[model samples]
Target: MNSIGVVYNNNHELHDYILKGFPSPESPARLKRILQHFVDNRVLENNNCKVLYPANVSVEDILRVHTADYFSFVQSRSLSGGGWLGNDTYLCEGSFEVLLQAVGSVLEAGKAVVTGQCDHAFALIRPPGHHACADKHSGFCIFNNAAVLARHLQHVYSCQKIAIVNIDAHASDGTQNIFYADPSVLCISVHQDPSDFYPFKGFIREMGSMPALGYTVNMEMPQEAGNPEYSIFFEEVGLKVLEQFCPDLVILECGFDSYYKEKLAKLNLTVDGYYDSVSRLRSRWHTIVLLEGGYHDDLGLLADVVLQALADNRYTKDEVNQVNLLASRQSSCRRIFDNKLNELKKLMSSYWEI
Candidate 1:
């Protein structure tokens, strides 16, 4: 079994939205429940998993992806009694510290993997960062965690090629935009169709620009699309691109919102699907999994599945019936998914072997 390193903010509640008298899906309860489930199940005790606490990252690290003005704005707002920062994102008095901790934990996870301290690492962090861009925050994200980690790997660890695969229900627009024109980093986001969703920007045609034409890939899953669709997409398109790019490290922007139980989004990835996705990636490359967005109660269960996949262990069993879950979706979901898959393949053929 592979040893896994787990890192999370023990004081994540410091950035609580409830303390600000605002009720939001992105709350401290998300991480609270996940940590509780981990403790109750002894997820860390088995599988040779080590829990790690991270220190705050420096301002220099933050500036690697975000502009100075944006960083200052967040710090200032956080100090002056935090409030809304536009794009449905909010900041609390302790949000800045929380953001630093989140980024720091992610970096520590990456360090654990790159240095061979562990085979893989999972940063069970909050206030999802994939939506935050270089100059703006969106979708409750304040810092682009994956982007910062990618940059850190390149500059600090001398990793030349990095691939970021996002399975969040919503597209990873911020991470995509940050490395849109850079060829060193390949970004692949498989999410619910952005047409009728929040942050409606991750379409198949939004490939990268200039020198990195085919670096950015977006697979739009139709509503009700579930395990089969995700499995096929990864097998046919996602894995093929990864093979071509041959990244030194693969960062998985894992979000449980794609699960069938999520109310904020409509994707049907059950425990088994999540396992298969991570297993396929971990089978080939060193991976660093970063928690993105998911407000459901099943976060703990799914997090277990991720750890199991990383360790190549089969301790967790899927309680949900996959057959019935798939059957509940409209038949047209497959047809729409097939069409989108074809379109993506055709567009990608120019850049990759797929």
Candidate 2:
């Protein structure tokens, strides 16, 4: 497996708003350091090679999935030193370039997989995009990176069918909103339920609208839903949907927010869960992995574990502690899993054969 990690943001420093004077939670410098740790550990640097692309996502590329007016608005704000288009998002002077680079990196990832330059690739981008919709931007996302890559494959490469799977704890609201009306791209989000979460949207009942009904699948995992449920969803329902959709290529909106260590969302996915999910996808479709959101101290560590799975096509020796992870399997988690899987089948069955 030849996987590449592309980055655009040199995340400069910012003061933390909630901390009301402290440093920002997300720093490009920190992201760089985290990526470096992955390289140093031989998780990435010792294995598949990497390629860097310039931070320039064309306006036309932006217009493919986003509104021309919204593109103009984000660009205009980017000119004046960007900051907070909404919660958890900010526009630094370099944010415009950073965001473009992020999209460019994802586009490059798609190119690698589709062209067979590599068996798989990961775009280690910043300014998370899953939250940004077609006309609005929020939740630290200005533009949807996964959506960008999907459109790149569908339009430029002539992929007739595409499947986008988001594993972020928060719903892939932006990606979902963009393709909600398009039947060609299948958008499936596995995230924390909207009962009380940021950008509250992904619900079991919220399938796609008319003309594109059943194309949008939202598997809203209850808070603290862990590896078992994730695996079941992928093996039983999720992958089956992919088979039914018959995508030419797969674009993964891979987010680490579901990691037990992450503070952004309450899902309890361990590093092992991340590995298993990627490994499953590796077997089925040509995958383009784009980072979405994961605000935890161990972003680098978790990222390394995820790459291990993608490269090896199996779970690496359990590096992260698995104590609590096992406990989830022993608890009432199975009941929850059964219930969620049953609900998911009910929603996806109408569209998928299984």
lDDT of 2: 0.76
lDDT of candidates 1 onward, in order: 0.93, 0.76
- Over 4 Å off in model 2, which ranges? 1-24, 313-316, 319-333
Candidate 2 lDDT at 193 equals 77
| All candidates: TM-score | 0.99, 0.90
Per-residue alpha-carbon lDDT of candidate 1 for residues 1-354, written as tens digits (9 for 90 to 100): 999999997767889877787778999889888888888998887667988778568888899999999999999999898987668788899988889999999999999999999999999998899999999999999999999999998989999999999999999999999999999999999999999998999999999999999999999999999889999999999999999999999999999999999999989998999999999999999999999999999998899889999999888877888788877779898899999999999999999998
Lowest-lDDT window of 10 residues in candidate 1?
A: 47-56
Candidate 2 per-residue lDDT over residues 1-354, each given as its tens digit: 546444434432331233232245555544665677766776656556565554456788888888988888887887776556556666765566667877877887777778877777778877678988888888777888888778878788898988999998888888888888899999989998787887789888878988898999888787778887788888787888888888987888888889987876788888788888987887777777777777777787777776776677343465555665656444665676678778878877887876
- Which candidate has the top score in TM-score? 1
Q: Candidate 1's error at 96, in angstroms?
A: 0.6
TM-score of 2: 0.90
